[model samples]
Target: MKIYLLYTGGTVGSVGKPLGPLAGPRFVDAFRANVETIITSQLPGTTINYDYFTPTLDSTNMQPADWVRIAQKVLSNYKKNDAFLVLHGTDTMAWTSSALSFLLPGISKPLFVTGSQLPLFFEQDESYTLLFNTDALRNVLGAIQFMTFAIPEVALYFADTLYRGNRVIKSNAREFTAFSSSNYPALGRYGVLPVLNERLVRPAPSTNALNNHIQKVAADLNIIMENINRSSVIQFLLFPAYYDRTSGDSLIVSMLTQLSRVNPPLRGIVFESFGEGNIPDFASMQALLMDLSTSGIILVDCTQVYAGDVNYGAYATGAWLKGAGVISGYDMTPVAALAKLVIQLARDPSSPKDEIQKAMSTDLAGEMVIL
Candidate 1:
């Protein structure tokens, strides 16, 4: 089987004491000399092809344009390769994976994203050597094995489990199991053998359907690229604050109102609100939010709690947000919500506020539960 490996630098490809990413060509060479040897010996007849971004970026520096570039490369090479593996930074891997799910809907082949907390190789006497004790090699190998299953979704493989990409979040910074999918079950698990939860995997689309999906994606991408520069979407985390006793002005209100007045005009916001999507009912705060909604800003309310769905009407505090035009982001991680909003706004800058709200509430790529 043939697999296309796209190494867009991350912790897995870094070296040196300070942990800097290796150049694309250098990492590719080291990968072929080391990891490639082991894979070929164990699984003969596996052909691995390589590609990478120029001047590799840390995951922290990744942007929407970078995501567009990655999607374009994968779609252009979709027909020739049997499956695709992306070596990405654990920091924003979920966002990239989630964006890919929307960008390449109904993908028929396996596409896995993974990275490690530790580098795959260590520098010894000015030379790079394999670091067998690290999780980097293990995760990559696991992804390689899982690809043979032909799982037809964009998934993230880390540690010993494979999860639906959009459902995952970075829950741990120091451990090898850095990702967790609180609302969705594992797509597969790696133990003595790689076992798949076949029922959860999406069925591969028919040839005609797949081709049509690709055409739509290509067309949408052009629109996204054209509007991406003007797309201004953000995530706002709520906290306890009150209207100033003396000034009668709320910090929350001031900040959001100022944001709304910026050049691009803050097209959308994902409010990381309190339990069950509740927010403080400060009058000025409520008024500013209502004004923003009336002015065509797409507002989404997502829960700050880690593992629960957003229920806007369950409590009185949350009801006002819904009444003011905020849509519920049911069980979607903040990362998924932010990426989805950005993609939707970029795909159609002039989309009506209600239309954008509907797109956020709907489960386009298994990112959220509608119920």
Candidate 2:
């Protein structure tokens, strides 16, 4: 099996920054050598090649431009590889994976984006080349086995669980098991072999001589990215009652007013409401949301709750938001909502506002639990 590795840099590509106890060898070099050694000795006949991006990025500093660059890289190699693997950083790995879920459409191959909590070189076991870091090695190896299958999704393989890229969030920063799919079950888990949950995977895209689905989607993204203004999308959170008591109307109004002043105007905003998408039914708050709708701002209502769907119409507090033309965010994580908005806005399709609303509620990238 052939796999193309895109090392976009993360802790996986780093060997600690220069400091008293941190300085060391570049991780890309060490990881490359170990990977080659493992393939030659342990998995004969399997080929894995990689490209380390220049000036590798730390996920903490990642951006939309970086996301687009990765999309371009994947498309560049799509025609030549059986599957693709991305070595990304845990900090923004979920976002990158989610973003790619939107960008790469109609794919019929496995694309696994994974990284480790500890650097791959930290494994206590010293005799192994690739198994030096148990968790890191397990994920990479599991990803390898997945590459040999027909799983057609952008999955984040972390710890021992495989989550749909858009459905996972970095739940812990200090643990080896750093991510979790709170609203959804994992696509599968890694064990003696990669046990896939067949029901969780999206159907493979159909292709015939008259159509090369992957190529068409890539071209569509290229055209869309060219027109997308990544900076124009905004995200705002509704604070607790104290915020409203302190000056809620002015606070929310000022935020949107400033957004309106932006050169190209605000394209969309993901409004993080309270539990179950609830927000004060204050007249001023209602007015602001109505204003946003009239201003053609795409407002998507999401919950700040950790693991449940947002149903604005279920309660009276949320009813006005639904009436004000805000789209319910369902069970999407904030990170997924933002990244999905960026991708959807980039496309700049006709009837932009309606399109954004539809895309948010619709499972374009399986980023949310709509039911």
Candidate 3:
């Protein structure tokens, strides 16, 4: 079986260069040379052919357009190959992997996305030491199709563990232990051999070709993400802790005001309160929430906890926030809620006060656990 390799820019493709910061390691030549010398030479009999995305790009600057490009490339080469291996950058690797898992619905091939912390050409000879001598790459080539679902999803392989993209999160910056499958179990492991854990790798349904089609969900869905910017309309960032108002001192007030002053448009706040999603509805805090709700800015109450559904009606504090128009973020992480809010601003652009709240309560990327 032929394994087609797709090389996009990442630490894996970087090489030593003269410049100071950005010139650390660069992909100066075709990736095939590195694959042959670093990967194939040591493995000696692995059946894998390679290809590279022209003008390989740095993974840090990866965007939504890049995900679309990756899907298109895989589709272009879908028929000719038995399996695919994508060399991606570690940073934002989980986000891209999740995006691809959702975007490319009906995949039947073994699509493995892997990368290194230090570039393959590191002076330490670290790439050859860890990768070339191991059976990790060779074993994945055995199963080309998604085991359970008809459409195979994308995954990240690092530090000898294969994790589901949607459940994986990047936790480190400088180590090989860069990602963790926090909310899920490892699909498999790579030690002396690639040990396939049957319990974790789900089985795929054998479906016909006509049943496969790319779902056009993006154009119809309102999706976007942005960091705080000069023109950003975001204001309040509600901290989640469902409890009584125990810690509302000058420090909290000063910090919130300072944050608002730096980017004044973000004019609302919500606290993912304590148990059952409750927050102190003190007279002053209640007025602040009500005023923000009235002023057309977004104020949300997300859960600081995890692994459970949000219960807006479970406690008196939660009930009060609901009455005050403090939107419930359900189970969304702060990052996801912030990103979703930014997307809403792009979706309607001229949305009214209540519309933003309504949109946040809904599930767009299968993000929230609405009860």
Leading candidate by lDDT: 1
RMSD to the true structure for each prediction, in A, is: 1.7, 3.8, 6.8
Residue-level lDDT of model 3, residues 1-371, one tens digit each, is 55666767676656545311122223323344444444445444445565566667678877655665665566666676666667777776665666565445555555667776665543334332224433323322322222212124456677777765555667787666777754357777766666656566544425622125423333323132222131243334345333344654433344554555445366345454565677666655666566656766677766655444457778766788877777887765443455456545544556786777787788644455576
Order the candidate numbers by lDDT, best to worst: 1, 2, 3
lDDT of 3: 0.55
For candidate 2, write residues 41-101 as lDDT tens digits: 6556777767766667677878876788887788788878878889888988988898888
Q: Residue 298 of candidate 3: its Cα lDDT?
A: 76
Higher TM-score: candidate 2 or 3? Answer: 2
lDDT of 1 by residue, 297-371 (tens): 888988878889888668888888877878889899888998888898998888887788888989888898887
Worst 10 residues of 2 by lDDT: 16-25
lDDT of 2: 0.75
lDDT of 2 at 361: 84
What order do candidates take by TM-score, descending? 1, 2, 3
Q: For model 2, state the Cα shift of residue 323 in Å.
A: 1.4
